[model samples]
Target: MRRSRCLLPAVGLLLITTACQGGSSEPPRATTPGPATGTARMAADSALRWSPAVVWSGDLNSCRQGEAAATRDCLTKAMQAGGASADAVTAAGQLSSAGELAYVTAWHEQDGIGVATVAYPFRANTNEGTRLIDAGGKRIDVDTVQLDDTLRADPGVQALLNAHPQATPFAPARAAGGTPLEGGGVRLVYRTPLRECHACADVGQLQIGYDFDATRHFVGQHVVPTPAP
Candidate 1:
């Protein structure tokens, strides 16, 4: 997925809230396959079906007004407008840098597909004024590196993959919460196949956490199971 350029300015901002809680060294509970009859069977299949478009790409400037709460409200509305269930749409987390709001919603009709959305408000004052006039009034261009750029290039991601070669890979790290560790990081979750149940629709999720600093220095790593839906 292409990262939104509008959110780059908020890369330095720390997440104020996380969507997933209960961080631990333990893995998340495995999803129990529902009864293979009637509506339950249909629901399971729907959840696994991928949506052609499940992301929220609307303007988030209103989120800047009330901070996290405002962002959640905006997300709730967007999800609903996008045909999401009211109960399914929830506030997952927020970023302190740009007050970015993260949300997680699920749709069973599409085979139980889980949708995670991260919305960031634009900051005009951030990373502005490339050329500033000194006392001598000389034009000088300033070079700045965005925090998001640094985190993406951080080697910690590769290290995590190296340590766990068996992990199932998912694209575009998710923004989550509930970790006790400090620093910024990407959230990668992999699905493990169910044992002895090749036909089962439900599976387990392994969440891999990699933390980094502003300069993209590696902080630490953690592995846990994603909370059961």
Candidate 2:
């Protein structure tokens, strides 16, 4: 069984509460929860200033309407290119399936920009991987992943895990409210099995997520040269 990590105290304020619109709410949208010491705590404190929110279309039923159709088309092409089409389409369908496909939007607090990450039912799969998509359903990027060496022991990831006994690397929260938050929002954290070292068999475990700030401008995805390990 995958060993569990301690969780940090759920801090900050919950501005809104509704059934988790996406698939899982285990990982908050900002940073991971775990133990932290001196400088690590300071770093996390600074990062929390950015308010983050996950956005998706409010009306899924009208997906074929407006920019929804184009978004679907772009995802279809992405699937044809060898990315996970099945999962991609399913995610798209979730918006319309629920009778609402509100154009999902996310905020990048640091840059003060809002970028649409996914519609509702945001799905993340090892087989599917990450891809670049446009508001109009254009194919812009493929098989993207982010890795960080400092995250292995970062306080943000550590403190949360330490506080909650149920927290684990690959496990979901046993309780609904036992999750971590930064400042005013939560961070969506996850792990991907990729090599982080040349000689070591370590996978590129990630703890990154999306944040949406309406004022921030969307810069194109930063192309990380490393491939999924």
Which tens-of-lDDT digit does each residue in 151-199 have in candidate 1? 3343432233344333232222332332333344332222222111334
Global lDDT of each candidate: 0.31, 0.31
- TM-score (all chains, Cα) for each model: 0.21, 0.22
Candidate 1's TM-score reads 0.21
Query: What tens-digit string does per-residue lDDT give for candidate 2 at 96-201?
Result: 3334332223433222222234433333422122222322333221223322333324444344335443333331111112123334333222233223233434
Model 1 poorest ten-residue lDDT run: 6-15
